[model samples]
Target: MDVATVKKKVIVVMGATGAGKSRLALSLASHFPAVEIINADSMQVYRGLDVLTNKITPAESQGVPNHLLGNIDPSVEFTCKDFRDLAIPIIDDVLSRNRLPIIVGGTNYYIQALVSPYLADDVVEDMAEDSRISRLTDVDLNDINSASAFKLLNEIDPIAANRIHPNDQRKIQHYLSLYSTSGILPSTLFLGDTSRKWGRADNFRYNCCFIWVDAALPLLDRYVNDRVDSMIAAGLLNEVFDIYKPKSDYTRGLKQAIGVREFDEFFRAYFAADSSWVNSLTNDQVSSDDANMFTKPKLSGILNSHDSNTLRALLIEAIDKFKANTRKLLRRQRRRLNRLKSDFGWKMQYIDATKAFQDESDNSWSVWVVEPCVKIVRSFLLEQPGFLSSTGAPYNVLHLTSKDLCTQYVCEACGNRVLRGAHEWEQHRRGRVHKKRASRLNKCQRTFSVDQQAAKSADGELNSTFCNSP
Candidate 1:
C-alpha cells in the first residue's frame, strides 16, 4: 500500500507576522469535528513577553486546545529539533483521538521539520556521535571573528562557504562547528543529494495541506505599523521592561524577539539620564503597583513628568526602527515562501488577504479568506483527487540548484558584491543597478585610454623637438 494513502492529515497555516494566521486557525476550529492547534512559531514557545511575542490570549483561543505556546522557559534555548520532538507526540495523541491537527505560525522551518522526516542538520547531528569522529570541546563562538571564521570555512569547505554570506557569522560558525565535531565537510553530507538539502517532499511524515495567508506589501506595511502602535497602546513597553536587564544577550532566547532589542538603547538612555525615575521604577516599586497601571497613557504621563525630551525622542526612534525591522522581516518571509513554492516545490494554497485587510471586516474575511481555506481543508480531509499528499516535485531550476548551491559569484561591477549561486548572480547581472554601474565603468575606462593616448602623442612631439635641437 502507498504510504500517502495510510498517512494521517495535518493542516498547516503559514504567513508573515501580522497576517492573522492565529485568527484564521482559531476560526478553523469551529468548522472541524475536533481540532487542536500546535504552534510552530519559534518565539511564541517562550513563557514571557506575551504581548511582545503576540501570543494568543485564552479568551481569544475560543476554547480550542493550543499546545506548545507560552509554555517553555524564556531563558532556555528551544530549537527546531526540540519543537519537533515535543510536537510529534502531541500530534499523534491528537490523531489518536481522531481530531484534526492544525499547525499554525510564521515560523516556516518548524513546520518543515515536523512535516518532513529528513533534514540536513538533524542528520549531521546524528552523525556527530560516531566514535571515530573527533570533537572540538573548546570552541568559543564569541572569540571567532567573522572574517577569519568565513576564511577558515572557505579553506576547509569552499562549497559550504560559497552558499553562505561572509557576514553571516552564525551559519559560518555552524558549518565550522559541524566540520570540527563530525570530521566531515558540511557540503559532503548531502553528497549532492537534492532531497536532503533542506528536506525532500518524498519523505513527508504526514499528508499536509499548506495554506499561506498573504497580503499586498503596501497594505501589509500599513497594517504592521498600525499593529506596532496598537501593541504599544496595549502595553508592549511594559513587556519589554519586564524582560529588560542590563547587558542581556539580545541574540538568545526571548530577547531575540523583535521588540526587545530595539528598545535597548532607549531604555539605557532613559534610566541613565534620570536617577529619580530609576528609583521610582525599581523592582519592588513596580511590583507594588497594579499590573495594569503601566498602560501607554500612564507611561507617557510619567515620561512627560520628567525633563525627558531626549528620552522621548529616543523612544520614538526605537518605535520607528521596530516598525522598519518588521517590514524587512515581512519581505524576507515573503521571499522564503516563494522559494519554498518554487525551488523546493511545496504545494501551497495562497490566500491573498489583501482585500480582507483593506476592508478590516469579519464579513469580508469569512468570504475572502476563510471560505476558500475551509473548502481546501475539507477536500484535503476527504482525500479528494488533487488534494492528496503533495509528493510530486515541480520541474524547476532545481536541476541546476544542486551545483549552484555550492557555487559563488562576485560582481566586479557592483564594487565586488558577493552573490551566492548562479541564480542570484544571473539576477544581479540582469538588474538595472548592475547594468548602469558596468556601463559607467566601461565609459570611464574608454575615456582614460583616450587621455593616455593623447598624452603619449604630446610627449612624442616634445621628444622629437628635443632630439632635432640636440
Candidate 2:
C-alpha cells in the first residue's frame, strides 16, 4: 500500500466520558515509537480538582509526555481559541521531532479548533487592534442590552442572528463584537467557506486519524454511575470541599466540572447545619461580609462527624445528580461525534468498547478495544486499505447542511421558542410537548371563533327585532 498522505499526521482519540479514551491513548502510545499525548479534555486542563475532573495520574500516563494537562489556573476562563493557539504549536513541535501527537479527550470543540483553521472568535480577536474597535469605550461594549444587541445583529446579519439563541447573551455579544470591530457582516464569514463552519472535516490542518471510542448507552450509563461511585471513594467530596467557596462562579474554569456544582446544595446545607463553626470564625480569618465564612480545614475539624440525616440525604441527592449529569454528558458527546461524522464528513473509525467494559479486565480491554485500535492506527499510519473504509453515517443522522446557519424557526405554539437549524426546529415540532401545546392552542382558537360568531348573531337578531317593532 502507498503510504503517501497529507502534510502532517496527527491522531485523535475521542469518546464520551468513562469510555477509556485516555487508557486507549496510553495503550496505543506503548505500541508506537516517539509518541506524545496532548490533553484535550477541557476541565482537566485546569489545575486542582484532580478527582472531580478525572485527570490522568502521572503513574497512569507512564512518562508519555502529556501536554496541556492540569497547568491552567482554576480561576482563568480557558476558551476554545486558547486551546487552539496553545495546541497548534505543541502539535507542530511534535511533528518537528517526528513524534506522533495523540490528542486524547472528550472535548470535541477543542479538537475541531485544532483541525479547522477558522474560528469566529479568532477572527474577532484578530480585529481587536483595529481603530474601530479601539475607539469604543468599555461601557459601550459591555452595557448593550441583549435584546437590542440581538436586534442590531438581525438588522446587520440576520443569518448569524438566527444561529444564536436570544437567551445566549455571550454569543450575541460575540457576534456583535465581531461585526463592530471588523466592519463585516458576521454571516459573511461562514457563508461561502465550508471550512469556516462548525465541524469542518473537508479542510483539515493535518492528515488526521480520528478514533471514536464508544460503548452501548445502557452499558455506558452503568459505567458512568460506577465511575461516579469510584470518584466518591477516591475523595471527590474532599476535593470539592477544598474549593467550596460559597457563590463561586461555576460558569468558568475548573469549577465547571460535572462533580463540583452538584455538591453546592449539600455543602451549603452542611455548613449551615453547624452554626457553631461559623460563630468561631474570627474577622481576620474570614470576612464579616464573606459568604464563605468557614474554611474547609476549620469545617473539617469541627463538623466532620456531624452528618445529620438531612445532610446525608442532600449528599446522596448531590451524588445522584452528579451521576445523572455525567450520563447526560455522555449522550451529548455521542451526539456531537455523530454530527461530526455525518454532517461534517469526518471519517471516524468507530471502535465499540462495550464488551471490554463489560468484562472489566486488562486482558478484555487488550483483546476487544486496545489491540483492535492499535491495529487500526498502524494501518492508518501506513495508509493501508482496511482502515480507510468509512463507517457510514448512523441511521438517525439529521442530514444538516451549511445553510443551517441561515435557517431559523420560531414555534409560536411552544411559547415562541427560537430554534436554530432545520433539524432542531423539526425535532421541536415533532416533540410530544410541542404537539400537545399546539393541539390545545388550536382548540382554544376554534372555540374563540365560534363564540365570536354566536355573539354577532345575537346582536343581529336584537337589531332586527327593534326594527320590526318600530
Candidate 3:
C-alpha cells in the first residue's frame, strides 16, 4: 500500500479510560484497509492483565494484528522511555511493509511523545546520585502531590515549568529530578544547538493522519458505564486479585484504575478478617437472617460480616466517577484535535460510531449497524478468514439485526412500516407516525410495558399481539 493512496496516514486514537480508544483503533484498522494498531497504553503492555487494563482480546484483533500489548510482565517496571524505544522499531517495520500504523490508548504522554518528535528524543535518564533519586522512591513519588512537585520543578527549571501543566504530577516529578541531578533541563537539552540532531524528527520520520472518535457527554457517560460493566463481566476483579500485593508498585497503578481499585478495597476487607474466625463462622452455618446481621451492609453502612454488596456498591461508584472523568478527558482531546487541525493543516475527522457508519455507507456503498461496543464489531470483522485485505482493510463489514425483532413486520398503532435504511430510520423517528404512536401508547390504559408495545408495533398490529402474540 502506497502512503499517498491511503486515506489516513498515521492515525492516533486517544481518549480517557472507557472512551473507546481500543474499539476505535480496531475499527479504523479494519476500515482503513492499510492500518496496523500500535498499542500506546502503558498498562496494556503488561502481560496477564487483559481484563484489568481493557486490553484488546485476540478475537477482537480480527487478524488485523496489534503490537506492544501483553508483551511485558506486570512485575516489570516499564517507563515511557522504554515505550518510545520499542514503538519506534515497530512503527518502522510497519511502514517498511507499506502498512499504516494507528497508535491508540489513554496514556496521553505516550501519544504526545510519538507525535512530537522533539520531545521523544529528550529522554529522561535514570536518576543518578542515590542521595536525591533514591530518596524519591516509587513510594515517595506516588505519595507526592502534583502541586508540590510543580513547585519543586519551578525552582529547578522555570521554562520547563511553563511547558508542563501543574496537574501532571508524573511528568513534573520526572523533569524535576532529571534537571536537579543532571544540572540541565529537558527543554534546554532538546533545544541546544547540538541537540537538535538527536530528536525523533532528525532521526526517524513519518507523516501522520490523526482522527479522534468523540461522543457527546451524555452518550460518552453511558458508554463508559457500559465499558466498566463489561470489564467486570470479563473478570477484572479476578485479575486484580491475582496481583494485589500491598507493597507492590503494580498495586498502586491498579488501585488508581476505576473498577480495579474497588476490588482492591474489597480484597483488603476480606484479608483483614481472621481466618480462624471465618472458619468458625463457616462451620456454624448460621441461618440466613443471622448471616445478614453479621455481614456488612450492601450499600452504605458498617457491616459485621463479609458481604459482597459493599464491594459491588464501591465498584459502581468507582465506575460512575471514572465515566465522568473520561468524558472530561474526551472533551479535552476534541479540543486538541481542533487545535492540531488549525495548526498543522492536516485532515482531522471527528467521527463517533454513528457518523463513522454513515460515512462508510456514503463512501463505500455499504451500510452497517454496528453494536455500541467496539469490541463486538471488531471481533465480528476479524473472525472471517481473509476478511481483511493485505493492507489491513476489512473485506466486508456485516450489519446484523436481531432475529427476534426482525421477525416482526410493520409499526403496530399507525400501521407504518419500520424504516430499514439509515436515512429512512431517521426520517421515521422524526415523522408524526412514531410521534402519534408514542403519544397514544403513553395515554393507553393498558398496563403493557413499552417493550411490549414496541414488539407489537414491530409486528404491525395494535391489537394486544405484543402481550398475547409471542
Candidate 4:
C-alpha cells in the first residue's frame, strides 16, 4: 500500500515516567487540527485515579475527544489484547471521520503494539483461540509479573525462549501460543511475505511517526518528587483509601504504580499502629537513660504525622528511584525506536516539551501552590455554561475551602463515618475502629498473595540497588 492509501496516519508519543507524555500528547492534540488522542497507558484507564496516574485533565483535553481512558472499572482487568480489541474500533472510527489518530502514553508495550506491525488482524485472531486469554479480558497486563508469563511461555516454545527476554512475558506468551497452535515460529511469521488482512471493508494500511521526549535524570527525578507532592496535596491518599475498601481490587494497579505504591506503604504504616505498639513495648522495657539510645521515633507517627520535611524527603527518595528506572526504560525505548526505523524507515523525533514550555512562558518560574480543595469546587460553578442571574448576568462562582471539602469525624470499631468535630475526630483516632480495619486488611493482603507481587518486589529491589550503587 502506498502512503496515501494508508488514509489516516497515527503518531505515537511514548517514553517513561516524568518524560512529560501527557503534556506532550495534549499539546500535539491541541496543535494538530482534527487529531484525537487514544490513551495507550494501562493505568490511566482507571477512573478516580487522576493524580497518581498523571491522567490528562478535562481542561487539558479541551473538549478534544479521548478514547480508552477513565472508562474502565478499576476492579476489572485490562490486558494488551483487551486494549487491542477496544482500540481497533476507535482507530477505525477516527480514520473514517478523516481525523488523525495519536496514541499517546508512557506505556511502552501498549504504544509498541499499536505502532508496530505485530498487532495485525491475523495475530489478534490467532490469540483469541486460547480460553485462558479469554479470561484476561478485564485484567491489566501491567499488574502481571513478567517472569511468571515468561516461565509459562518457555514451557510451550523453547526455541522462542532463546529469542524472548524473561522480563518480556507479554510477548513471550503471545509467540509461545502462536508457535504451539500454528506450528510456525512467531519470528518466521513476523518476517514472512504475507500481507496483513484486516477484512475487505476495513483493508487499510498505516504510516506511523514516533516521538521521544528526553530529559536529564536529575531533572526528571525532581519532577517526579514534585509531582508526588502535588498528588498528596490533591488528596490522592484519601482517594486511594476511599477506593481501597474491603475486598476491592481497585487499588491493585494503583498499588503497583510508583507514587501510589509509596503512598500505600505510608498508609499501611499509618493505620496498623504496630510501630507504635512496638515502640511502647520497647520503651516500657528500657531504662530512662537507655530510652535516649533509640532516637528515631516509631514508624507509625513518622508515617502519619504529615511532617512536611519528612514527607518531602521520602517523596524525593522514591522519585530518585523512579528516575533511575525511567533511564533504563528510555534505553529500551531507544532500542525499539531504532528497530522500527531500520525495518520501516519511520521518521522519529525527540522533543523536550518541558524545556519548550519553560522557554515559552514569560514568568520563567516554577512554583508549587496548594490551593484549597474548595477552590476546585468553586470553579465547578463558573464552568457551567447556562447558569445566569435575573439581570441576565452570570452567577458568581463559589470557591470551596479545605475544611469544606474534608470534615473531621469520629467512628467506632468496624470503620464508619461519624459526626464532624475536633472531639469526634480525636475520639475516632483513639478508638478501635481503624485498628480493626487495618487488621482485616492485613489478613486480606496475606490471603490474596499472588506470585507476581514477589517477583515485582524482587525486581524493584534489584533495580533500586543498581540505581543507587556507584
**Number of the top candidate by lDDT?**
1
lDDT of 3 by residue, 118-160 (tens): 4523433431322342233343544556777777677666766
Compared with the true structure, all predictions reach lDDT values of: 0.80, 0.79, 0.55, 0.53
Estimate, for each residue in 81-163, the C-alpha lDDT of model 2 and write its tens digit. Answer: 89999999999999999999999999998899888866766555554455342222343645667787778778777878877
Residue-level lDDT tens digits of model 1 in 269-332:
8667656556656655654244334433445554445555777778888999999999988886
Clash count, predicted structure 2: 0
For 1-470, candidate 4 gives per-residue lDDT tens digits of: 57554334566676656666666666555445687889987888877677767787788788888898888776665666567778878998998898778788776656555544454435545544542422333334445456665665556545556454455544555665455444454544433322221111122244444566655555665666676667656755555654443233322444444444444444444434346534754678755344333423333234455667544456445545544554565555555444433323344455544453344352321111112111221232233344221112222222111112124343434444444334335544665767777678767777668656888899999999999998
lDDT of 1: 0.80
TM-score of 1: 0.84
The 10-residue segment with the lowest total lDDT in model 1:
288-297
Q: How do all the candidates rank in terms of TM-score, highest first? A: 1, 2, 3, 4
Q: Indicate the residue-level lDDT of 373 in model 4.
A: 16
For residue 334, what is the lDDT in candidate 3?
Answer: 57
Estimated TM-score for each candidate: 0.84, 0.78, 0.57, 0.53
- Model 4: lowest-lDDT 10 consecutive positions: 365-374
